[model samples]
Target chain A: MSTGLIFAGTGAILFAMGVAGVMLLAHLLRRILAFNLMGSGAFLILIGLAQRAGLVDPVPQAMVLTGIVVSVAATALALALTRRLHKLTGAYTLPATRDD
Target chain B: MTEFFDPLAWLILLPLFWASGAFLLGPTRGARLAIVGVAAQLWLAIDLAVKVGDGGTAIRHAVGGWGAPLGIDLIADGLAAAMLLLTHMVALPLLLYARGYFAADASVARYFWPLSGFLLAGLNALFLAADLFNLYVTLEIVGLAAVGLVAAGGNATQIAAGLRYLFATLIGSGMYLLGVALIYGAYGTVSIATLTPLINASAASAVWIAAALMLLGLMLKTALFPFHYWLPPAHGGAPAPVSALLSALVVKASFYLILRLWLGPFAPLTGTIAWLPALLGSAAILWGSWQAIRAVRLKMLVAYSTIAQLGYLFLIFPLLGPDGLALQAGGMQVVAHGLAKAAMFAAAGAMIHVTGRDAVADVAGVASRMPVSLFAFALAGVTLMGLPPSGGFLAKWLLIDAALTQGQWWLVAVIIAGGLLAAIYVFRVLRQAFLVPAQGERRHLSHRAPPLLEWTAFTLAAASVLLGLRGVDLLRLLAVGSGP
Candidate 1:
């Protein structure tokens, strides 16, 4: 396979791994890390696709750039929330038994 | 460029300008400036509405004077302009209410106004963005600002709720990015309009997977049914105005994107995707209503109600397919639910402030003590119940009619059942607040609330009721892109 296709396939596999990690993992922090991996994989795939197409489209690349910023913001906020929740009720895991 | 003359341009800039000024003002001044900022935004929103009505459509500047497929485009068709109007109008009152509520908390002041401005800018920009990637940027601005606002409370429960909200949104945005990337790989473009014509290959695994991933991501962010675990606690725990904004507009922003894409660029994909949204929406309605009925606290109950009410918006998808009564009803339900639910959350916020209690039973005698707020709550409840002279009622009526017209009996059953369940819970709060309070020993409010807070709630509730009468106008606003 060409380098571009290899990178795209690798990114896709990483994206799937991230989704699976989130689904299977019990730890919130790990799940967060999985989410980051998923996002990074997506960025890689976008760049790989642009390269394969033989042109750099600013649109998708810019979107990935913006997504990185948002992911960090969301992660920081989640971490802060995690710290606060631990302080309040002393429970770390999400309460899986939803009444509804 | 004369494109700057587009009123939509100001709608975008007004909030950004406010964010800049709010940051410079800092904390104490920021709060006042935030209120002023929302007021100005509200006015601009109104102006945009009028201009759209006259012109039939609205589109503003291209970022660098390049057209679509090159540089970004920011356009506000009737649907977007209406959303913008609703958002700013809701923000205006909530900010005023927040001014009074957050007056004493000094530390949070630094982040509140600027973050709120950022949130508003994100919301407006998201509504106007003409490209998928541009929409992504706007989503981040909103996500960060909102998470900041949630954690600003700095309590353990608030923080936990914020964290859950963050995880869900992050995973959601991640899924969204992946989908966008896949579409770009296949189609070589990211503008939604450009992707519209490229939506072929229905049997293709990559295409279906991308669509599914995107839908799931949006569903999680929108807090539809099974994915809604994070919503109730976080919204219930946040400061009242923040809760109101989150419930009223923020969640709706993501849903609006789902709507924009589903109806606009992804129109062809609807045949495959419509069933899932409709199914998830049904589940959300039943499950959400069940939770609302059993909720202990008034705020949590309202939060659950939001989950159910949001589901009502999804019912439009299956009905929106063909041009028929079902399609019209589905479209009308969107605006109806938006107005009614926002009113409900604002009213719930006001109640919490006046009574200083979160429990439903403790709401006793609130009607007698705070007549205006209570009246507002009841009016909002009427809307929720789909009773006459309320937008909620009209939306439901249209939805039910559409369900019947489309022969979707299950949806009809769910809609009616959900409406009945809604009435039960709404009355539960109403009876506890107004009548039960009379039977019990009357308790005085421990604190006096500022008049502005009460008025803000009352006006929002009144607007919801007024929306029922003015359904024609609101529906017209939504008509910019899709016709009834």
Candidate 2:
């Protein structure tokens, strides 16, 4: 397989693992990390698929940079929210979905 | 590209400019600037609509003089213009209401103006975006801004709700980006106009996966049925103005993206999967309304009702035809729900402000105590119930007409049944409001709501009802630049 396909395949595995972590994990901080992993996986796939033929494409590279910025903002916000929740309620996981 | 005056770019940049200006100006002075800014946006939106309607073509703009396939493009058609107008119309009154609502609480207002500014800017850019990657960025802007607004309450419940909303929105946008990546890999282009013909020419597996990923992500964001768990808490727990903005506009933004993609590049692949959204929509109508009826809190009821109402927007997917009747019906539903839901949430906010409580049962004496707000709530309920002289009535009428024409009797049944269920939940609140409180149950009013707050809610509710009479013009506008 081409280098691009190989990297995309790995990215797909990472994405699956990230999704599983997000869904099955109870810890909010871990969930945030998993979310980042999911984002990174998608970014990898974006760049990998574009370079499947070994020709460096600037478009997906540019998109990956933009994606990373958005990911950072999202992560920071998530961390802030998690910290606030912990400060206020002293809990790491969300309350039961049916608690309301 | 710079030669001609472009209202599209201004519609976006104006909000971002005012948002920053508001941030630096502080809460009190910033609010006035926000009002002025939104008023200008309303005018620009109206002008764009008139221009698109009169010209009968979509207006397209390439950023920095770089054409598509290499740079971003923005396009505004009748459908987009209508949404822009709707956003501003709802926003103008809500801003007025928010100013009065948050007058005493500077903390919430401090972030509300700038965040809402970012939200409106993101919405405008999303509506005008002609490329998939650009849409993803706009989605993130809207998602983050909305999450910040929800968390602005800073209470434990609100913060937790915000965190849940944050995760949900992040997942939604992440999936959407993956879909965009796949589309890019498959077609080597992200522009909608360029990809439409190309996608129609091929039925590759990658295209199908991209469509599925994008649809699912948008569904989660729109809070359609099964994925709706995160919505009620985030929308219900936030301050009233935040809830109004979220329920009325934010969800509709993602729904619009779904419709845009379905009608554009994914048109050919949509036939086989058309029934999926409609099926889920039927479930949402039944399930969400039932939950709304059971909700103990007033805001939660309105929030749950939002889920039910959003289901109607998806019903048109299955009924789409060459005549565009389903499209018109969906547009009408979106506008009607947008106005009525905003009014309902605003009225509920007024009631909560006066009563200083959030429970449905606590509104026992609201009818006599705050007649204007109670009347506003009832008037909005009229629209939700799909009663006469309301936009909801006209939208349902058109939807049923289209369904009957297509021989989809089941959809007709779901539509009618959904309206009936809506009436139950709406009346549940009204009945409580009109009830006479027992001797010991009477609660003193915590504070009198500002007349601005009550009147703004009333005006929006009245406008939603009045839309029934003038829907033809909107329908005509919806037809501009669309296929026959």
Candidate 3:
């Protein structure tokens, strides 16, 4: 396959894997990791598409870069709060049930 | 070059400028500043509306002075301007309500105000954004601010819920970005205006794939039907005002984007696949209503009602054709629901904060104790149930009319049934408030909650009633600059 097709296929695989990981992973942090994985795959597809068009537009690149930073920031904050929850309860907490 | 002042920029900058001021002054000073900020922004929103009303359609500030596809652009169509006005108006009362509401810590006062301003800024930016990528960035800013607000509660459940919300939002954003990439690759540009002219049946496979991915991503973000798993916990679990904002305005912003895409870039492709959202919408209406009916917590019931109401939004898709009457109904539903539901959530917050309980059974004798709050809640419920002289009634009237006119009476049936379901849940609260229970003595409360919060809820609920009167003008605005 051509490089564009190869990259697109790889992106699709990564997307699938990320989705499956989100479903399979029991831990909140792992699910977050899966989310990032899906995000990276999306970026990869965008990059692959840019390369396919044969002109490296700075716009999509800039957007993806911004996306990466945002994902990291959100993940960091989520991780911090999750850690706090674990510390508080001595158990890895999910969402509160209706019983609460 | 400058015939008139570009009013759209004010829509964006007013809140942003205020946010910076709020940040500079710190939280206590910032809280005071937020009041002024929201007021100023509301004034600017009014100004934009007036200009748009007179000029027919407001389009200004071509990014870098270039046209579509070549550079970014900002256009304030009637729908956008109206939404801007609504958001600013809502934000004004909400900021007033926020003042002194959080007495737990001074840090909360600080963190919350700046984030609210930022949220306003991001919302304004999202409404006015012309390009997909630009919309994505603005959404991120909005999303992060929202997550911060969710986490600001400083409780374990709240934090855990915020984390879940954060993860879901991140995934949605990522998916949206991927869709943008696909569109950019296919069309060689990401501008909505540019794509509107270019997108057609002959468009590349990538375009169709992009549309699907984008819709899927948005559906997840908007919490439509099967994807609505994220909404109840997040909206129900957040603090009262935060829940109010999330249910009222934040989710509406993304839904607005979906409407934009449907009307703009994806108009031609509707007949081929428009059934998708309609089908999903039917499910949402039924499923959301079912869930709401069963929810024990007041907030959860309202949250699920939001999911069901969103279904009404999607019903417009299959109905809009040459005359586009159905599309107009959808627009009205957007405004009506936004007003009514926001009012309901805010009133619920006020009630919960007062009584310290969310269970329906626990709210006995609240109506006598907090008459204004209870009255506000009932008034908002009137709109939700599609009672007369309310925006919800007008919207449903339009929708049912369209359904009958098109011979698609099933949608009409769904709407009627959904409204009935809404009445069931709403009356559940009302009955609990009004009916005297056996156990409790009448306790007259000393500390009446802030008058501003009560006024805010009443004003919002009243707006839903008012929207019915002004529906004609808003509908006219929605029609501007868009071809049937």
The best candidate in terms of lDDT: 2
Compared with the true structure, model 1 gives a TM-score of 0.93
Candidate 2 residue pairs in clash (backbone atoms < 3 Å): none
Best by DockQ: 2
* Fnat of each prediction, in sequence: 0.69, 0.68, 0.59
Q: By summed lDDT, which 10 consecutive residues of candidate 1 chain B come out lowest?
A: B437-446
Better of 1 and 3 by lDDT: 3
Which of the predicted structures, 1 or 2, would earn the higher lDDT when compared with the native? 2
Q: Under CAPRI classification, how is model 2 graded?
A: medium
Report the lDDT tens digits of candidate 2 across residue range B130-181.
9999999999999999999999989998998999898889888888998998
* TM-score against truth, every candidate: 0.93, 0.98, 0.94
Evaluate residue B134 in candidate 2 and report its C-alpha lDDT on the 0 to 100 scale. Answer: 92
Off-target runs (Cα >4 Å) in candidate 3 are: A52-55, A92-96, B1-5, B64-70, B103-107, B441-447
- In Å, residue A25's CA in model 3 sits off its true spot by 1.7
Candidate 3 residue-wise lDDT, B1-484, digit = tens: 4523466666667667777888788877787888887887788888887778778866567755675666668878778888898887777777777774665457667678888888988898898888999899888888888888887876877777777777677777777887898887787788887789999877788788788777787778888888887788888888777777888788888888888888789777656888788889989999888888888888888898899999998888878876868877877888888878878888887877777778767667787667887888888888888888988898889988888888997888899998999888888888988895524443545556666667788898899888899989888877766562
Return the clash pairs for model 1, or none. Answer: B365-B437, B386-B393
Docking class of 1: medium
Question: Which tens-of-lDDT digit does each residue in A1-100 have in candidate 3?
Answer: 6676677778878887887776567687788788778878888887777775455677667768877887787778778877877876666647445631
What would the per-residue lDDT of candidate 2 be over residues A1-100, giving only the tens digit for each residue? 9988888888878887887787779899999999988998898889888984568989999999999999999999999999989998899999876423
* lDDT by residue for model 1 (B1-484), tens: 5666555666667778877888888877778777777887788788888878777866566765687867778887777877888887778877877787777776776677887888898999998898877777787778778877877787766676676677677778778878777777777777877777778646357666677777788888899988988888778878877788888888888888888777766676667557778888889998888889999988889889999988888888888755545444544555556555666676676777766677888778777667777777778788777888887777888788777877889988888898899999998988887677434333644565577777788888887778788888767766665542
Which candidate, 1 or 2, would have the higher DockQ against the true structure? 2
